[model samples]
Target: MPAPQMMGIYPSDSISEVAHSLPIDPLGPGAADLLAGDVEYRLHLILQEAKKFMIHGKRATLLPEDVEYAMEALNVEPVLVPPRPLPIPSFQPVSVSSTSSSSHQAQQVYHTPDDEIDFAAYLKQPLPAGIASSAGVKWKAHWLAVEGVQPAIPENPAPGTSRAGPSRPQPASTSLRPQARAQLPQELQLYFTRLTTALVPPTPSAPETEPERHRLAALVSLRTDVAVAGILIYVIKWLSESIQKCLMAPTGTIGQLVDAVDAVLENEGLFVEPYMHQLLPPLLSIILTVPLGPHPPSSSSSSQPSPYDVRQRAAEVLGKIAEQYGKSYPGLIPRLVSTLTKALQSPPFPSPLGAAHPPAGRYEGAVLGLAALGSQAVKSGVWGKAGEGLSKIDELAGRLYIDGGKRKNPLIRATIKALSPLITAKPADVQAPQINMNEVTNAFGPYIANGLVKKGWTANELLRLRKEEMEEGEGGGEGMDMDTPRI
Candidate 1:
């Protein structure tokens, strides 16, 4: 049986015709047949390689560039052709009558027409405008997924949905729908992804590891990047959600989130005054929420910070906000003081009817938050005169002390911390005024009096600071008086 014919055929007649046209002697039948078969085989290989290129490019139609690439890959000399606007032309069929009258049948031939250009008309036409050069290429990294869930971001292809089926409308609920993150620019989306992932890394890293470095770098970007205004709302939303999720099981992530807030506040380029209302709720929640995390075992030697430490960091961020925007929003500090004071004054006593009472952690957090507001805040919110300010605190402390002496220690420590801003030591040369313990106790109640005594504060100094704070509070504005108790 004859060998099977290949997909392509370069006839020996065509090869002979080409040889005759060239300045060479006509080839023999065998030479012409061998050349035709070899040409056909090479053409098949080139087409096969080009098809592979097309598949790799995820395209159905083979392109001229694909053919060029295939030729280079196959070690064949590539044909350099300029790119054209139109696709390759198809062949047109023509029928010709036979020259001999005996042969009545006509012969058919297929011919490809050449492209024609009018140079004179092209030269007369106006030149098109040159395209502007693009910015230089730079490398950027972003998270594709965290814990197996892909973040809805512009960098990732949108999740596929069936276009053939009718879309179902989702029911509206009280919960807010997440922001349309797809509309954000690709750069901002990537930046947000990197910052959030670094802030709360999935796998905890040692202080010296790359994740820690990345966290610090992300914070630095937050503190210094001028172009981050576009992402401010999203960052704040992520922060609020992360804080809520981690509140019950406090981790280093909470502290990192607080640090991110502080970093955002530190950025001089951003005008954070507008978002302060949204920002304060999360910070206040950190301050007032109870059971932030499981209390660490007293015997554990792990280096991780406790939930109290996270609260302290959050309080510091609150302080920064007040200090930075207090003048612009004079009511801000007052509002914070009011909220914190309510938390601090909530009765810790167990109800006779079995009603729940606020935990001691809330009181401690309120104390820290008040202390962070500065000396004036401490005096107004924590050091009220005779049954007005901190009266509830003294009662709570006394009750805790009577029930369990050691249990009261944390509250006393927190009280002292709150009063630290008001404590100013007398000069070494000046004799410290001495006061009877009984008088101090009767004047300011036993709880605060003891805390003052521990800090070496004389009764006269306490009275003097209280008087000054009252005077300042009166002169400041009506808002300041709202936090202060009536005389």
Candidate 2:
């Protein structure tokens, strides 16, 4: 058996107050002290045992139920109260008034006081139907918005200002427009702030890892969380740089990052539509420049496979964005065309390996970007026949393909591929000549002779002579004499 534990004695005054409240006469002087001591001793024992229950349950905090169970184990009898019997009654009719006939109240009755309840029979009665034993709750899921735009639904409708409708009459003193933009929700703001910190590398040395990627995936799944959509601009720029550095990274991971960015841009309802101006520059820079990572190498090296891979990815995303939001964002197409053309014309970094390789590689990326941009570039006069720029672009593409005989170069290959679509000819639709040259020349000969007649000859006479000459020439089917008429 374990030795009993002792604890500090409780205040006697508190004990006396509890005793007086319990329908007991106030204890006299030292009697209160004795009662308090006994009660404290018992309480200390219960608590000592209750701690063992807490430990057994692997919990740090002690609860009331633990003390109750401990008391039971210690064989301490609980305070008992006998259950009161329910009353039953005998009914007697009461007087009713005719004027109260329409009242929903039931007719009055009198009950006799001597009746008693049949407790056993009441216990045996079945519970009423449709009454639940416990409360139940169900959860449902939905999207409130996509990007930063609120969607119209039963729970969250578009705001009154976003909708176009007739305004209700208001006092002339009041302005119709809302005064200021509403503040964002605290939780959503915190979520995106953390997400941006995690997803965007504050330092150049931060390594791309699985945990960060998973956080991004979770955020991406919340596409309808419009509050986070505006932060995508920063996220996208970071991803554009990430893909540039990790061109050789595992396709699956990098591809997911690409998909996430694309998904945000593609979301139809997001009101962050104006951010497209900011969104595309990073991607365009990546597509047009070589070695676009934060600390890109200044010199050309064999280690880099030129700019083909990163440019290919950026070009694809550029094409999709142009196709999707072309009309909504008119400037995107023009900017893409101009950037690509300018990059193609940019001077290469002078390198020991070869000065031409760097510029040629950049040109290749630009061409690939243009190819991905497709007919838009052509329509925008990027490669169209109208401008000096178009001719220069053609000449540049031609020189890179032919004069730069390094067939193994990615720049050369991409340039060839880009120009292929534009220069490739479909078979011309051949048709026979509509009119013969010989017949037309013969008919015009007489008119030529009449106009060239000497000054002495009358206009009428010259015309008559030319007509006679033509009739003679037509009948004979011979060629005109060159010495007879200069015409």
Candidate 3:
């Protein structure tokens, strides 16, 4: 039997037409048949590769992009075709009579019509604007939901809506306004809210009684809570703002703020070293500010401790800070001493040279602050500079005594207290040598000498301390000179 002839989807007639269009003689029967079969096989291979791409993409139908990708994968040069809708071709029928006339058949051919243009009209027409190129692919991120609540933003889908349409609106009472969620955990947020609320005092008009009980509880939490480091910044911010508000117009709240500071300082779990800069300003302001709260009415006999008492408490807090951090931050003590010295040295009244003099309350606070820094600071800041600090205090105290008398005058007591550290012997059993009163009177001036005598300090102790202070100053000056390099 003869071998079977293979069939091809491409027609020999189409191959012959292509040869004629290339300005070559129409292909012979054998050549046309061979070419048609090869072309049909290549088409099947290309289609097969394109089908794989469509399946990989999970697409039901093949696209032009898939065909391009398929051609590239098969090492064939892909056709560069602009994306457009495929035009429908019209089919026309033609009758052909064979040479024998016995065979006649109708053949159908499909061809797309060419688009005709009128050159004259086309030349007169305005040019179409060029299409802008699309932007390159980019990626961005935005929060879709936080803590199970979807945020209301353009990127997030609207609530109660879908691709179909919006659903019915819920009742006004049932719908809640979306609030911005805190970055903190839920438990921490609740704790912070409760802590701050309890710490802040109630306003005078508010009927919430027992603000003290709440404040004390809050302070205890600050002192004892172990996991409060996370909220440390928030607490510091609250303290700073509260101190500022209280400084502007002090109330019982100012005293509570001091207690809160002390409580935070006492917490061993907190690493407050980083926040010391922020903590110090408010504390210093409290210690140095005059008349922390309004003076009580003279007619009423109010038993509340005056603003001076609050200032004293502030000084104690400052002293604790200095003792704890003085070694770590070497400049802390000097800076504090400088500030208090300036306040202490200011004239009791406005000077004739128009210098700004701090109030008597500030003078008292300065003396207390210097004394709180320990004996060394007291010696250097108050009793150093050839006893100028003491002379200034004596002048201020004299004026106070004349106005309010010695019993009521706080400056007199503060000055005496500041002197105690210098005059008191370090060892209990150590005996100070006896010195003449005239030498003591001349060395320290009359007022300080008299005050020392009144405070039960002997002339010998006063002169001895003054002599030691001078000798230390001379030794420090020599040490500095010896350490200096000569050019």
Candidate 4:
């Protein structure tokens, strides 16, 4: 079969002329045509490569560098063409002015002292670059004259109104309050994808089989980078919203998320410490109120992990975080106490779309959240304050025990266990433990005082050794007459 013809992008006539332009060459009959065909093929390849370069650079216009880069990538030497100087346009001076003005006026045409009519030279002169006239080009119909006292157009907008012409349409409000997640920026979307994947892999099959790869990676990220921690907070917020809007429970991802949070609490890194104040609210919400996972089918037996289990896990995670970081963030305890008290007191959610009170698991979660804060939270009458000395937590726990001691209610039992230490002893009898200042100072030695004075190097003996080493180094020399004692 005859070879299929190749379509040429460059004009054959131009290529042929360039081929013939070589001084010593007399044209062979098909040589010019062959060269033209080759040139066309090369040009087509260059254009294709240049298009790819343009796309990679995210530019619509194909620049000279794009072609050069394409040539370099393809191992083709490119012809360098020097840029020609721009032709300077000349201008003839024309005098223009208002003829109606009776006062003496300066000449309308401005000129340098040389008086030659050279627009380029005039432009090159060290003078301000601007239109000679005071007026700007008007693109739309503007009221040149406004109400008598209102500032004229372009200088200032009319009083109380801002348009020179009809105003542009206002964008539709994209308020995401009741329904959807807020639209994240493109960069944030990418970060969210990477972070969520790092938190909980897409196809997590078993919790115990692997070494929690994504969870470890996320903790490492939190330990080092504040920005990563912020991204995790963003993810947590988004997760809360997702749980709120979800029609049914999600898969076991919620448990994985709780595990990831627990890992962060366990890693006592600098970055995660300061962000606890911001981190606690969403975490408490997850424990006290947010849905954990998809509800089991009604036909399924009670053997399936109940919704309360997820809340309990979230509650445990909260307790761990509070036990670890709550001292640093004092406000966290009070907020948790308030939230738990409210949840415990509030009625169950009436329906899917009603004023949100709390869920069945919320009561349990509230107790757990309080327990996470330790005994002080319960002793403070977080549930309520009846009188000057009456303990509300004691009163509530007593009532629950009386109501269901034999029933073996887990939530009530947990609450009772948490509050038991605080309530068992009267406040008057439980005196604050006394500390011997001299004993503490003697046990810690001068190290504590030295650290406070010096701002570092807490171990006094180590500091003394370091100082002696430094002093010895100062006395030693590379070359010395050791035996000769001369003054």
Candidate 5:
């Protein structure tokens, strides 16, 4: 056995290197007389050290440990240094080394990686005799906890300098080290143990909402997530088409729609519902016309691509599906309305009516959403108050697309068409169906009437449609553009 190295040999040697005798100078005392034999042996010890200190052509003699080594070599007997001729190398070797001593030495040499973790425990006590467990600990992979903004590891932790960066495990150190454990208060030890135990075993991870996001930049990279998003959109839209084609999709499909929507909304932080409300009218405009034949009029097909048979279809369909299942989708329409209302209603900056809030692209969206509900109603033959829905949207977004310069917007004309009967003087015998017209008429009625007025239609025609609206002054009903659900 080579035997365990004693602490006395290393750090004790270092401390003794300095003279107990007061130094005559700040640089300190020089070495006293030592025998030639001692100098030779000391040179031998220097050779034993690993070739770690070489710089240029010279080895440094500056370490405190070097001084102690020199002193020890000096103490050897005079005869040992007496010069003699060197012998040739021998091939003979000892048979075997003792297993017990070898194993112990291995244990002493091979520390668990966790022993190298960040803090130097020896500094908290007495300074360590030698380099404390190889500079630092491996960052135990187990130490990773819930993610949040982590503070920087300061070169100098004291206030002032710009933060270096948040500390993260060096790539080499990213591994689990079972031996590493944090000391905890007795009161909290079990809690910590439980936490560490829970963390160390790889907890089941929720599926990657976006692994593709890592490779692709948010704005640029053609989203791999786009495939996923597209699939979801396809599924939802197909479900929608199936319903529109089959007259009301199965309730289970509705569940799948919800799950898909929630998964998307949660992941993207986008509300597909309102966007659908915004997107669908345009899509259904096509879908509605899909029934209208092979030589479908250029008027129906021109200006935009159809929203069906593709994933881009999803964006439009998302809004409609949300409208399809009211109340089941909270934070859907109201939130959308709030955002879109702010945008459309916002004046240009440095103008009247509050700081020009950003536009939400909702004016057309609201009209589209209400119209989608109308399509569903019309398809199901459920007129309920969809007629009234058209009216309500009229009060809020004032025939902007229809009369606000762009007489060319197809959606504007579509809105007028759907509610044409309600807006024009309907014969009393044209019975109102007991379906939801609130989403339709309230959302579009006024706009239809106003379009008539702007087109120079008679007042009799305005009076012809049921004016559920509260007239401006007398306010018999809700005033112009009240967004409250007429349902």
Candidate 6:
């Protein structure tokens, strides 16, 4: 069996592509009314459904068409359209001086104000809430639109209403208000009853209306992929927004906005767009310093973040960004050093008269980022910054070994590593402690004279040496070194 004929075939992962349509309404009562979001949830559903489809030797690619089929199978409302045609105006002109104008005009021309959108009610909608938080569900509608499954069409909708057609909220069977009952004309009742029945989605007829049945005899695939696709889409969008701000903003607005990048950085998601680690520090630096006006603390009670916390958080995000997409980032050394130094300061001194503030973090990563830059720059053909980069190693070493508590641990080892690449480093010459006279004389003066005599030095030379030693010994011998080896 020649390899089971698995030739010239390829599979594509479309989770990121159809990710825009990740939100779907899962089954249950009142699900229609509940806002449907949770794209991550939807993706899991799609994966499960896709797995079943795979066993039958189907194409692995989850195309938009496949997603559409999956949505239908799952009984999800991925698309909505205008339920009825709009009241078209025939363009008939009317005279302003018509006889029955005042009361009649008010009745005809005035429109009711939109019922205030119940933000609470909207948020309570299951799907919308999740989309807002994680971001994938909101884009699902667009995904469907792109796939030719149009948006919900509205009937004769209220004026000033956003007419994403046909998707009007029919009063739920469980509306808050009590139902009013009255006898209606038989024809009207029949028409309404039929419409309601059509509107009410029944449990999907499985293994028949579903695509799986067309291909296989007994397999029934239930794929509710909308949620995950939507979530991924939302995240993509969120990342898009983040990337735009990170890359395009004149200066970052990390802390300036009410809902800023702090949420994203602190949140639990990494595979974001333009995912460069170097961007993180710079991004945060922009936030902390830039923007036209300083972002005052939220309240007196809100404590300012310690320099260490802020710097660490930024560093952590950068580390992950680098780990995930370091390939895309250029100028990592300069960018990292630039940002880390910013982290170590409270912004630059504005002027001679500017108000002073405390120092930023001890510039913890400056040494590391610059050190890494020294070697990395050489490899990347960015050797121009190497000279300046080597300076960081010396600076860090000086701080560690001479200034900052004279630490002698991993920090010193790291300093050494950082300094190893520099051509300018020399072993530091520290002054020796005071020495005993006995040690000095025994090691240098008389011992040298004795050794010289034993080596057959003339008596004249010995007498000269003894007289010189006596003269040198008269003083404190601060600069004496009469024990020069002669033999």
Best first by lDDT, ranked: 1, 3, 2, 4, 6, 5
In terms of lDDT, model 3 sits at: 0.71
Give the alpha-carbon lDDT of every model.
Answer: 0.73, 0.54, 0.71, 0.53, 0.36, 0.37
lDDT of 4 by residue, 452-476 (tens): 2322222233233334655666556
Residue ranges of candidate 5 with Cα displaced over 4 Å: 1-316, 323-325, 348-362, 373-411, 414-487
Question: What digit string (tens of lDDT, one per residue) describes model 2 on residues 380-406?
Answer: 434333223334543454444434332
lDDT of candidate 6 over 1-487, digit per residue (tens): 2222222212112333343466743334422222133444576687666555554457766555665566777887676567898866454343343356454442223333445898778766677555567844452222234365445545333435566543422212311112211344444344333322222223222335643233222111101112222233233333334433432221112221212233333334333454333335454452233221122323421343333333344444555444444456555545655654444332333322242432222334443343444544222221123133223332433433323332333323333344445323333573333334343234333222222232222223323343555666665353444433431
lDDT score at residue 277, model 4, on the 0-100 scale = 56
Off-target runs (Cα >4 Å) in candidate 4 are 1-195, 201-204, 207-248, 273-278, 290-292, 296-305, 320-329, 347-359, 381-405, 423-487
Q: For model 3, how does the per-residue alpha-carbon lDDT over 285-312 read when each residue is reduced to its tens digit?
A: 8777755554432332154456677778
Candidate with the greatest lDDT versus the true structure: 1
Q: How far off is residue 59 in model 6, in Å?
A: 42
Candidate 2 — which residues are off by over 4 angstroms? 1-184, 197-209, 212-219, 222-260, 294-306, 329-331, 346-357, 376-408, 419-487
Instruction: Give per-residue lDDT, candidate 4, residue 295.
Output: 39
TM-scores vs. true structure, each candidate:
0.54, 0.37, 0.53, 0.38, 0.24, 0.24
Q: Give the 10-residue window scoring lowest on summed lDDT in candidate 1.
A: 168-177
Of 2 and 4, the candidate ranking higher by lDDT: 2
Our tally of clashes for model 6 stands at: 39
